[model samples]
Target chain A: MDGFWIILSGTLIAISCGLLGAYLVLRKMAMVGDAISHAVLPGIVLAYLFSGSRETIPMLIGAAVLGVLTTVLIELFYKQARLQIDASIGITFTWLFAIGIILISVFAGQVDLDQDCVLYGEIAYVPLDLWFTASGINLGPRTVWIAATLLLLILTFIYFGRRGLFITTFNEEYAKALGLNVAFWHYALMGSVSLTTVVSFESVGAILVVAFLIVPPATAYLITTSLKPMLWLTAFFGFLSSLGGYFLAVWINGSIAGAMATVAGIFFLCVWIFSLIKQKQASIPFRA
Target chain B: MNDKTAIEAHNLTVSYNRRPVLWNVDFELPAGQVIGIIGPNGSGKTTLLKAIMDLVKKSSGYVKLFEQDLEEVRERISYVPQRESVDWDFPASVMDVVLMGRYRKNKLLKRLSKADRDLAAEALEKVNMLEYSNRQISQLSGGQQQRVFIARSLAQGADLYIMDEPFVGVDAATEEAIMLLMQEMKKEGKTVVVVHHDLQTAKLYFDWIVLLNTRLVASGPKDQIFNEALLQEAYGGKLNVLSKVGELIKEKDFPVREK
Candidate 1:
């Protein structure tokens, strides 16, 4: 039962990451997600300092806001200073993340954060945090509910605003010309991505969070060209990777987050090999 | 609508990093005219279009459509940017591309209506691409892709259409189809402004010509302005000798003026 809850929660987190990751991949903002994932540490630390608690809600909110701010700052630098995007992302996130590292070292004794746990979470123990009602109805870990609710919100937004999101991602200028508030849509999408990243941070950790956000969708992109199909495939790939990685972790006595990321990498490799084989086969001559 | 100028640019100047690209360009296209804006590379032809559309910020000046500011009158004007400006591999079909044109009319949070779908189909039909409506945009040929973009503009259903090098990378048949479509739009009393590169087709297609070389060299009826002197001026004064010879004949009060 505990293992079932762990897999379920991990699957929910993966789905949330996949849902927001599709737009990030389409916008070519995958690296920005990586940067934000790293850069949110300081916000998390600061939220802990201010609140004097390790509650998930405040830390997630703080981290999400900082992530959005980081994205905006990157855009401002790109637009106003004419800086290259990669350079901007590297400069902004590295500085913020370094500051986070400094803060964590300075306040090491007081805060519950450790460098190892921030980078790779203890996913094996997540199910141990599950709570039950008076009737012993298991409610699962809090991360599961948070991830599920975030996934639902993301799916609802995508379902209703699919056309707007499609146009905005495909050609922002055309969307603006068509009188769509493209800037609003951009920020909204980025905010959703940041929110998902921060909320899933505890379950997946910061470093492996990027693999969850980028790899599944990227694998889906390799297999399909349509957005809707790619999204469905990405969710499926994410779920499969989570399940496979959980079992692989149990088999190898490895970190669940690391195992999940390894499984995603393996899935990408399989797709790459399949595509190469298909291409090679297409080039061969056939005897009648 | 037929009598008023569809587009009017007044003293428009655009620059990049203090280097002027378009200089004090003033022009107007009367409604229902198929006008060609002709200029050499780096002669501010595309810059003029971008400035008019407010895509690129102008250093100084204003553009008006039907006597209203460009932003306020945006819905009445449709712009088809250069084919190279967009990623062809973007995950959208031809029909999806066309439906983007109707986004302005649809309310926020509202899905595309059945009428919008029919309009998209009809626009694709006008470009002879109704069959390719469901195909991914990257699967289309270069000419077919240009037609799809033209269909997107057509779906906008605006009074004025501004196209930037719609003929680039297109086959001759596609060019002729686009020209015929422009003529049809003219007959329907819609103004079509095209940024043309081919000099040979300039005289064959456009009824009105605006010769630009970082400025408005001349703008008027094609027959009146499509002459050696204007072409020389627009081609960066290479034909200045011919103009000088005509000037000498006028000074000598000679007849015929060198044909």
Candidate 2:
């Protein structure tokens, strides 16, 4: 029962991040998602310092604010300073992440937060943090409920904003000319990226969250030709990675999040190699 | 000609970082005509189209579409940006891209109706791309990509169509298809304006021409404006005097160029 619960929580985290990550990968903004996850570290530290607890709500709010700020600063560096996008993202997130690490070390004795936990979280302990009603009505683990709610929210955002997101992602200038309020859609996507990063990172930690955010979508992208199939494939790949990774962790007595990220990478490699072989086979007959 | 003016710009001046790109451009285009905006490289041709669509801010002057503000006539106008401006590798099919044309007609949350889907199909059929509706845009030839863009605008069903460099880097067949589509739209009493680079085809493709070299050299019927002198003025690469004056104006930090 404990193992099942842990894997279930991990799968939910993977699915939400994978779904949102598809759009980020499509838009060539995968690194931006990575940057947000790292930059939100300072937000997490600040929220803990102020609230003196690991409560999800205040931490989420803090992460969201930094996520938006990270995007704005990246844009400024890219546009105002005329730097390359990768450089801007590289500069902004690393600085924020470094600040977070410094803060954690400075208050090491006072806070329960550990630097190792920030890299790959202790999702095995997730079942221990159960939520119950005042009358002692158990409602499963808090991580399960939070991950489920985020999954629902991410799906709703994608469903309602599909058209605008599609148009903008494909051709921003065309969407702008059509009067689709391109900037609003841009910020809305950034907001979703922030929300996904905050919730998923809480369980999976920085490294695994970044892996899930990019690897599954990238794997899905290689095999699928259209957005609908790509989305479905991404979710499927996310589930496979989480399931395989959880068992691998159990077998090796290693980090579950690390195992999940490794599984996602393995899936991407398999698809890439398979696609290349198929392409070569298709060309062989024509050449002959 | 007493036909209604489709686009009117008066004393339009556009600049970037204190350097004027378009200087006091004034022109009027009649409705139901194929108008070509011809200019040399960096003559602000694309910039002009962008300004009219309100995609970019104009340094000065006013542009009215169909005798009204662009905001008031947005639905009546359809703009096709350069095909090279978009990433062809995006994960969207031909049908998905075409369906975007109907986005304005539906609310953000509402799904596109069946009627909208039918209209998108009809638009694709007009461009002979109906068979490729399910294909990914990345698998398309350059010509097919251009045709897809045209099909998207066709689905817009606007009274005026504005395209920027649609003929660049397309196959001969795609060029002919686009030309036929434009003629068909003109027959339907819809205005078509294109920013064209090839001067040879300008005579045959456009009914009217707006010759520009950072300034409105001439704008009129093809027979009148397509002559040798206007061509030289627009593309002779000897607008040194005008550029010199522009430089002086910029150096002086003048609010407006003394034309």
Candidate 3:
């Protein structure tokens, strides 16, 4: 029962990450999510300094503020300084992450954030710490419920704003010309990504969280060019990786989050190889 | 000439990095006219279109659509960017691209109505691309892809259409098909502005010609501006000498002079 719940929690988190990651991938902002995840550390540390507690709500609020600020700062650099977008992202996130690392080291003894917990999380122990009571049923891990709710919110946003997101992703200039509030959409997307990252940060640490945000959706991108299929495939791949990775972690006596990330990496590698083979096969006839 | 001018630009000057691309470009098109904008590469033809569409920031200029600001008259205008400008492998079908035309009219959070779909189908039909509506964009041939873009513009149902090099890299048949569609648009009292190349077709296809070489060389009826002198000024002038001299200077230490 414990193993089942553990895997279930992992799968839920993976599905949520993968689904939102699809939009990030489509918008070519996958690295932005990575940057945001790293940049949120300062916000987390700041919230702890202010509130003196690791409560979920204040931490999430702080993270969201910094996430939005990171995006805005990147945009500002791109627009005002005429810097290349990738460079701005790299510079901004690295600086913020460095600050976070310094803060963590300075306040190491006082805070609950340890070095090991920051790199790789204790997801297997999540079931031990958090409990959920839904109606008459008692759930083992609170992470599962939180991840599921976040996933549902993301899905609803995507569903309702599908056309707007599609048009904006396809051609931002065109969408703007047609009077779609592109700025609003962009910030909304960034905010949602930040929210997801912060919510899942406990169950999966920042590094594996990045893998969750990137790998599954990227794997789906290899198979199809259509947004709908990519979304479905991303979710499917994420769920499989989570379940498979949890088992693999148990088998190897390793961290569950790390193993799950490795599973996603393996899936991405397999898809990449399959795509290469398919491309080669297609080119063979032309060569002949 | 009709009293209704479809597009009017006043003192349109655009610069990039403080380098002027267009200098005080002023022109107007009478309604229901097929205006061809011809220029050598980097002659600010595309920049002129982008500035007029408000896609590019102008250093000092104003563009009017139906005597109003472009933003105010957006729904009455359609734009078709160059084929090279977009990612063909983007996850959209032929119809999906065309359906984006109706996006301006749809309410927020609303699915594309059946009427919008039908309009897209009808636009695709205008370009003889109704059958390819379901096809992925990358699967389409260059000409077919160009037609799909044109179909998207047609689906906008606007009175003024701005197309950036619709015929570049397309087959003759596709070019003819696109021209016929443009002709049809003109016949329906819509104005079409095309950024065109191929000097020969300039005489055959366009009714009005705006010859540009970094500045407005001439703007009038094709018969008035299509002469050898204007062509020489627009295409032959100092650019050839500058380029030739530049290349020679690159290879040799001294300037090259022709005998």
Candidate 4:
């Protein structure tokens, strides 16, 4: 049962991140997602200092504000300074992350936040945090409820904004000419990424979050040629990785989040190699 | 001609990186005509179309469609950017791309109705690509891809169509199909503005011409604008290569002299 809670939590994070990551990967903004995960550190630190606790709401608000700022700054450098997008992403995230580290050290006397907790979270401790009602109702682990709610929110966002996201993702200029508000969809996506990062951060940490944000979608992308199948495949792969990651962690006596990321990486490699083999087989007839 | 004007630009000046690309371009295209905006490389032909569609921020100028602001008549206009502008490797099928043409009509959060799908299918049939509707877009040939774009815009059912380099790399059949479609649209009292490069086909395909060399050298009926002097003024020394190859004729007597 404890293992069930942990896997469910990991799977929920996987599904949410994989769905959003599909669009990010297709937009060539996977690195942007990575940049946001790291840059939201300052927001997390600030939220902790202001709220005096690690409550989800204030931390989400903080992360959202900083996430939007990070995207805007990246765009500013890419457009105003004419810097390449990768360079812009690199420069912005590192600067914010450095500031976050500085804040942590300076407030070391007051804040109990440690860098290790923020960077590589321990998922095994998920069962320890349980949510209860005033009437003595036990709602299982709080992380389960949070992950489920986040998944529902992501589903609603994707469902309502499907066309807007699709058209803009496939072709922004065409969508803009048709009078669709491109900026709104762009910021909406960034905000959702920010919120998801912060939610997953406590259990999976930034490292595994980044892995879920990129690896599953990339793995799904290898076999599929359409968005619908790609999304379904991404979710399936996410669930599989979560399930496999737990037992692997137990067998090796390692970190569960690290094992999950490693399993996701292994899935990606297997898919890539299989695709190469298939491509070679298809060309054999042509060569003959 | 006593016809209504479809597109009117006044005092249009566009600059990139502080250098003027299109300066003081003034042209009024009459309704129901095939108009070609012709220019050499770096003459801002694409820039002019972008300005009309309001895709790029204008340094200075305004473009009116049917004597009204673009905002007032957005649904009446369809813009097909350069075929190379988007990634064909994007994970969408032929039917999916064409369905995007139906997007402007449906309100946000509303699924496309059955009528929209029918219109999309009808548009694909018009482009002779109905059979490929389920195929992934990446599997398409260059011509098939161009046809898909045209089919998408056709589904828009707009009064005005603006295209950038629609014929640059399409097969001859696709080119002919697009030409026929343009002619059909003209017969329906629709206006088309294309950024064209082929001078030989320009005279055959367009009724009106707007020649540019960073400025409006000429804009009028093709018979008036396709003359040697206007073309020489627009192409500048770029015609030297064409004359040296002597593909057509009259190299020695024209502006093809080495300079």
Q: Which candidate wins on DockQ?
A: 4
- Per lDDT, the best of the predicted structures is 4
Better of 1 and 4 by TM-score: 4
Give the per-residue lDDT digits (tens) of candidate 1, residues B122-146.
9999999999878988788778989
User: What TM-score describes the B chain of model 4?
Assistant: 0.91
lDDT of 2 by residue, B1-259 (tens): 2339999999999987768898999989999999999887789999999989988769999999988988878888999999888888888899999988888834867988999899999999999999999999999987898889988988988999999999877778999989988899999999999999777788889999999888989999999986667777787755456955664556365223311
Q: Which pairs of residues collide in model 1?
A: none
DockQ category of candidate 2: medium
Candidate 1 Cα errors over 4 Å, as ranges? A105-112, A118-120, A132-137, A280-288, B1-3, B237-259
Give the candidates in order of TM-score, highest first: 4, 2, 1, 3
- Stretches off by above 4 angstroms in model 4 are A52-57, A284-288, B1-3, B242-259
- Each model's C-alpha lDDT? 0.83, 0.86, 0.82, 0.88
Sorting all predicted structures by DockQ, with the top scorer first, yields: 4, 2, 3, 1
- TM-score for chain A in each prediction: 0.91, 0.92, 0.90, 0.94
User: Ten consecutive residues with minimal summed lDDT in candidate 2 chain A?
Assistant: A113-122
Q: By lDDT, is 1 or 4 better? A: 4
Alpha-carbon RMSD to native, per candidate: 7.4, 6.7, 5.1, 4.5
Name the regions of candidate 3 deviating beyond 4 angstroms: A102-120, A132-137, A279-288, B1-3, B236-259
All candidates: TM-score: 0.90, 0.91, 0.90, 0.94
- Candidate 1: Cα lDDT at A179: 64
Candidate 2's DockQ is 0.54
